[model samples]
Target chain A: MRISFSTTLMVCLTFVTLGCNDDQASVSLPESAKPLAVDATPYLVTTEPADTTPVGEARESLMDGESATLIGTIGGSSKPFIEGLAAFTIVDQKIPCCAAEEGCPTPWDYCCTQDQVKDNIATIKIVDESGSPVTADARQLFGISELSQVIVSGTAKRDDQGNLTLAASTIYVKP
Target chain B: MLLPWEYGVRNLARRPIHSGLTLFALTTVTLLIFVVVGFIRGLERSLAVSGDPNVMLVYSLTSEENIENSSISAQIPDLLAASLSATVKHFGITHHSPELYLGSRVTTADQSPGLGLVRGVTPTAPLVRRTVRMTEGTWPQPGEVMVGRLAATKLGVPTEVLKIGNQIEMEGQAWQISGTFAAEGASFESEIWCDLSDLQTATKRQDLSLVAMLLKDRTASSEVDLFCMERKDLELRAVRESEYYQTLQQHYRPVRILGWLIVGLVATAGIFAGLNLMYGALAGRIRELAMLQVLGYKRVAILVSVVQEGLVLASAASLIAGTFAVCWINGLTVRFTMGAFALRIDSLAILSGCAVGLLLGILGALPPALKALHASVAINLKAV
Candidate 1:
């Protein structure tokens, strides 16, 4: 009986020792990949478009694959700039951006006017030759932040739900 | 020749105190397994059954994942009802419920204050939370409140404290408990519910926590999503209620894993205890076993008798433990951060406990039996 008990205890101790050693083994982690670089110089325009349309009106009127020159402020969601893609949502200038009126912390999100903000905001993506948005953060490419008014000349692509997306050929950053 | 099965039964009777001790040890271990497994099953079942796939929750994005922390404009429900009239309406009335959910200290007449989960809901709440049914009394009238079946357990008070017509106080106002409700054993059974507007008036809050709507079908989720997308001003995000609870279940995966580990450890200890008890019992019986071998019975026959003795004891232990768990432990209320749930010693817990008991008997007997049988009959008989 004593011998049997000793054998059982030794086996349990052996298992516990093995389990403890497994926890101490070192693990190697893989390196993170570098971010993709994109050039926005070709699409950058020094002069604003001659005929500009409000983002709200353009959202209502533009059909898919139609050309449009929409003017708007760089404000809608708190983070309007899309990460790893040269795309941003622009809200129509007609709706206030909450900076002056409400002293909202993330006035760029236009949260105070969120009810009507949807129709007034349109997504603008600077597409490359292959028609996919540039593989870089829009903030790094455009040097623009929330509440900056700009004009974008692009082809409007409307999804089935009538959400407007502007494939920009030119973007005029307001001084 | 084989020893009669009666020999094993007779051996157990010869050492009543020893056999009873082994039975007690085995029963205790099996009962512990039931308790741990019951906790895991109860917690999982509470979360799993809470979510309804066809129901959609619309809450402010600011609240992140917790719907209780979410606060949306009170008018949003009406706005949804008007904008998506076709989707929100079933027959003639709308199917949306704007609610106010929060945790607050509540006091019963006999009991001191205890933290309780409270929900301010309208009659429309039942339209979306379809599992809810009035177990007793009617829907809450103006100042009256309705209590969930598990509300008393959650509040750490006697069940009588929340009986229909009993008065409870919260938010600095005393309110009568007009009724009791059950949410099909869902987590909602731990909450105290009252009229939404009355709660708002008491709490002095104008905004609603979230709006839950019953969609026509699963595909109708997209329409609600589109509404949320278009009305960006609402800052509302829509999610399937089932998906939300599934995420909560995923969040609690670590706790369930810990429960399983505890069951494993306890069963391992029980097996070891069984081994020790069997070794002691067999040591004194070695001479008897060798005498049986001399009496024209094979060593395997004596070994089978030893195992049969252990099996009988373990099985009796399992039956006693299982009966005790079913009668006393099942549906025992357990309070948690998500409210309270009943410890479920359901079919699965009972089956697992029985499996452990049988495991203890077979595994514990085999090693010691083999060790005793290794000695020759001539050496064993001469010793005692």
Candidate 2:
């Protein structure tokens, strides 16, 4: 009777654990390919009717997939992509000039302060011919150091959440 | 002067139904106390396991600063990297990770509204928070989201059931669950993390909550704090993650206090129920006690036998409850505002429950056992 009781108690506990457990180790992910290599000198001077759109304009700019050229200072340069994802968001060179307004050093979010969050910051990713993110990240292949000025040409796409992204076809370092 | 141990044990065996009922009553009390103590320990462990001491949260100087509301310049990470305290490092990385936080209403798989704390993190986030590791899938892509292991529990669903291929909708957009991450005992396990820029665009708020960096030197926190103080124009404040959580405990203080109050009330009622059970068990046995006294055993021995029966019943009940606790209660997750933490039934909790069980048994048997011994041996014998 004691053994029977113990077994029943254990069975009930196992059911309870299976019911509300938080471990996700059993959940499997879809199979994926090894990361793709990036092009060493992937940048090309494209003449695809591109406009010298300001980074702020890119924020409110044309719909996704339209080509545009932007001049900005690469920010978040210290470590752009972790490993799997190769993307970077850069600030327009003019963002620092606007610091003299009502706010000084802004809280990083920039939403709570009276001054507007700098719209000149644009997210950019280097993509292959099919427009998927390349395995070899911009920093890994091209040494896209942080805060450096450059003109990049890419398709302006809004990720499903409407975050502006520039899928780059060509990037030109300013001489 | 005590009766043989077998006499007390056999007396308990004589009325199996009464003994079972008494055991059950004591078990209920012991279980409640055990669960309550487990909750308090779990809460403390959750707080203790989170945040690096040197990894200060640099945010707006306002009291209202939280993950979602606090914002600063886009160049804040760069500014902090320049501060260069000797103790601070980003593991293998060169700088800190800037993150955005938002607490929004998320719908569960069952279509119920649940709270989700969404974090938009740069890749360097893991470098600063060294505890986090990917359990499944790769790092999140722009359109993808990774749910923490406890994220689903906080959303009132099973974590294992939240599959990797499943998509979750928020603000009229669907994000694929690409992966899951675990942070050991930290509260970060209850969050959903996506690419920083994607979240910024989705929320349409391009700002950051704070920057995080790993600290090697224990005293580096003060130096970081001093850096923030000097940069008052930056409107940033430095807070140790542990200290922040300790303060956060104050916010949940009322809940903890209320848990203890409920345990106290229920425990008192349990003791009374056990007492009533003992009274009823002994009420019918008054003649047996008088007969035992008449048969040459000391009155003191009869009293000892009755008390012995109480202890035996309590120990049996506690055994059952303790088994239940080990199998079911230990290591279970409890969800709250900050995140979900697992209920911990360490040695202390088990010992406490057993101690309470013994106390209840003694209290329950004392009054009736005394009355039975003192009340008229001759009157009882004549009435019988």
Model 1 has fnat of 0.00
TM-score of each: 0.72, 0.67
Assess each model's interface with DockQ, reporting 2 decimals per model. 0.04, 0.01
Runs in model 2 lying further than 4 Å from the true structure: A1-175, B90-92, B108-110
lDDT of 1 by residue, B167-286 (tens): 999999999999999998899999999999999999999999998989887656655765665455567888889889989999999999999999999999999999999999998888
RMSD each, Å: 11.9, 17.8
Candidate that scores best on lDDT: 1
Candidate 2 overall lDDT versus native:
0.72
Candidate 2 lDDT over B1-384, as tens digits, reads: 668889999988899888877787788889988899889868877877785666767777663536567888778888787765533554456547789887877765556677888899988888788789999998999888898888987888876556798778765567888999999878888899999999888888767888776666544554465455334356676677866887877777898898778777877888889878888888888888888988888977887788888988888887888888878998888888787888877666666677788878888888888887787788767654
Model 1: CA > 4 A from native = A1-175, B85-88
Best by DockQ: 1
